[model samples]
Target: MNRPAALAVLLLLAVSAGCTDTGPERTTLMVIPAGSLLYPLEDIEAAFESQHPDIDVRIEGHGSIQAIRQVTDLRREVDVVAVADASLIPDMMYRPMPEGDGNYTDWYIAFAENEVVIAYTGKSIGADEITQDNWYRILSRPDVRVGFSNPMLDACGYRALMVTALAEEYCEEPGLFEAIIGGSFDPPLQVDRTDGVAEITLPELMRPAGDKVAIRDGSIYLLSLLDAGGIDYAFEYRSVAEDHGLLWIDLPPEINLGFAEHADDYQKVHVTLGFRRFQSIGSERIGLPIVYAMTIPADAPHPDEARMFVDFVLECFQDGWPKSGTATVADKQIFR
Candidate 1:
């Protein structure tokens, strides 16, 4: 151990430490996805961050509409947006930005599909008795508490309304929507039928008349309530129920909004959002097969990083996440 060699080693260590301390900062990619995507995306985020150590991924979940409103209305600068409804990207984000020359987003990729279901627990009232044949009747009982997301915010919320309305035709039981949902609201969520179509309008503010119905901002939030015995049943996505390991009964294909072949049948029911703010964007949400989509906003602060993350997410889906029943990959096409 010579003195000159020791001095050289100390100087080299100091330079190495200086270089490590001044490395480039990681880029933050902000993602706002549908509430239903929170769990899966958390897994995706872990994998993505592991592969790209220089990028930090942050995800926030909201009801599909609220997720878009966070950008389009609230003007939050987000890097990526993924929603349960593919049409919403065009429906809400295709318009011109308030302060920008271009629309919030010009395009998005439809990547996944989901279906609605009635989720319950073993502790749920009449859980042992509820079946596909008479689940609605069980939910309509006076002592049962039914929960759903806000129709004004979540895609699952409006789909719940559609499922019940469509059930009338599927089950040949008239007024089922009123029995399970409409009559439970304070102002009475009513249905207007015309030209072979059933339309339900939701007020700007919806409050349950009593304990019969519980409403949350997002469908995923109802999972906690269902677990805590706060609500006996909840209208949830099949994926959410399966993801959380809850018991859920599959509704008829005609009303589940899962099959693309049943798209025409699903269209018989429509939900109109009556909020004043929605008027500018058009509030009528026509029924369609549930499809999930994602996009990087035009004003995204980290478009390059967002694109890479989107690619990674799509790859994960293609690898077989749909097999879990969360959602089926819509198409095999990759984002370019």
Candidate 2:
């Protein structure tokens, strides 16, 4: 081959190698979210990424508490944080850091609402005859295995405990909470009335007794167990159950923690976490309508991208709660 032709061939090879050496770089937007929000967040991620190709969104799901702790306690770098409970941001993330690292977040927007329900499958124990009235009894049976998230790490866990405690009143069954979860955990659930108000105590570590009650890190983890016949029933968000196409029974609004009208009744019961993590300082979590919230942390590395994504999510939710089966919160609930 001629010298000029050989030089052209070598130059072409170099250009081709350079083109294939690395793909186009993209700005990453990290999202730390509650486990219950996983499926819906995934849908949102796809939609968001398609519209904003230059920005890549990454989602990491954990229990609501653990999700926020990933930012506040662990000081992990996250662009956006979405949680199952709207109140968690203020309870755990709004305070100033102990080491003078500033606050994790000053504000959050409450976007969606959900209700608690019993998720089961065709293969679940007593699937054919499990009614709302018989659910408590069925779950209490030795042959049945119940599953719930860890209250120390997830909001659904405490909410499940609240549901059982409320059921004792709604169903006119005394000691129902004790019957289902009393001796299951390490410290167990404690309830006592003082000053005409009922207070519940949750242990630092929730180690369930044997296989009777399966306690996982997040509520979403129990869905697989239910599908595999490893568990008879799991207490979970109604949206999650519906999203997964699992068979579920809706509880009354009073105990379901889904309605604003019953907010006062729901507030009658409160849960106190045993472990103190971050800025929460053992605050009591009062029951109310289940509202989901999201925020861009103050220390977020990708602040602009995070804000854009958060706004997109809020708009998506406002335009009829999109992908997620949860209901949109009132306009007043949105902070930014």
Candidate 3:
């Protein structure tokens, strides 16, 4: 081979190696969202990535509390944080960072809403006979197994406790909470009443006394248990149940925590986390209408990308891009 031809061949090999090493430069945007948002966010991620080939969106799902803690407590370099409960942003993230100059997050937008429901499969113990009106009674059966997320970790877990307590008054059935939930734990989840308000105290470790109750880190984890027939029924978000195509009995507006008009009624129940980690923030969690929210952390590594992603999500909600089955988008006015 001639010298010029040999040099050309060597140059081509070097160029090909460079191209393979760096074909496209992509900026990664890290997102931590509540477990319930996993499916919908996956759809969003696909659409967003297609539109912005230069940006890669990475998502990790955890219980809303743990999702925020990944930033505020663990000091992870998360760009965006979303949660199932709107109040958690202020309750857990509004405080000043342990080593930073500002709060973990300064602002959050409430984007969607959801309701708690009992999800079960054909194999559920009372699947043939359970109804919204008698769900608590059915769950109380000694032979039945019930599942919920850990209250100290997931918003839905605490909401499940609240719903059961509220059902007593709404269904005119006394001791329903105790019959189904309270009495199933080892130390027992205890409830105290003052006037019309019911405050439920959760033990640090909510251990099930027997095979009657199953608890996981996030509500989404319960879906697999329901599918495997590990639990007769599971308390899940209506959006999650619908997304997974599971059968669910919708509770009344007052107990479902989905209706803003029932906000005052929902406020009658509260959950107090007994974990020492929550002592700094005051562990009491008041029941409110379920609202989904998101924010960019103050110390986010990719602030510009985080803002763009948040705007994209809000626009999707406004345009009904998440679809109806995942969760109900908040009013269009809120997005404006």
The whole-model lDDT of each prediction reads: 0.81, 0.77, 0.79
What is candidate 1's lDDT per residue for 1-336, written digit by digit as tens? 122333344344334434333337888899999888887776677666656667789898877777898888888989999988888888888888888678998889877778999999999999999999999889878899999998877778888999989987788877777778888876788888899999998987878888888999876679899999999999998878877888999888888998778889999998988675554467788999898889998999999999988887775565343344433545754342
TM per model?
A: 0.86, 0.82, 0.85
> Worst lDDT window (10 residues) for model 3?
319-328
Please provide, for model 3 over 1-336, each residue's C-alpha lDDT reduced to its tens digit, 9 standing for 90 to 100: 222333344344334434333338899999999888887776567656655667789999887878888887688999999888888888888788888578887678887778888999999999999997678889989899999988877788889999988988888877778788888877777678899998998887788888888999876679889888899899888878877889998888889888778889999999988675544356788999888889888899999988878876765555332234233545533221
lDDT at residue 252 of model 3 (Cα atoms): 87
For candidate 2, write residues 1-336 as lDDT tens digits. 222333344344334434332337888999998877787666577666666667889999877877888887788889999988887788888878767777777888888778899999999989999987788888777778898887777788889988888887788877777777776766666677576456788776677777888888776679888877789899988878877888987788888988767888888888887766546446577887788899888889999999889886775565333233343367736563
TM-score of 3: 0.85
Clashing pairs in 2: none
Clashing residue pairs found in predicted model 1 = none
After superposition, the stretches of candidate 3 with alpha carbons farther than 4 Å from their true spots are: 1-23, 97-101, 278-280, 319-336
Lowest lDDT sum, 10 consecutive residues, model 1, at: 1-10
Which candidate gets the maximum TM-score versus the true structure?
1
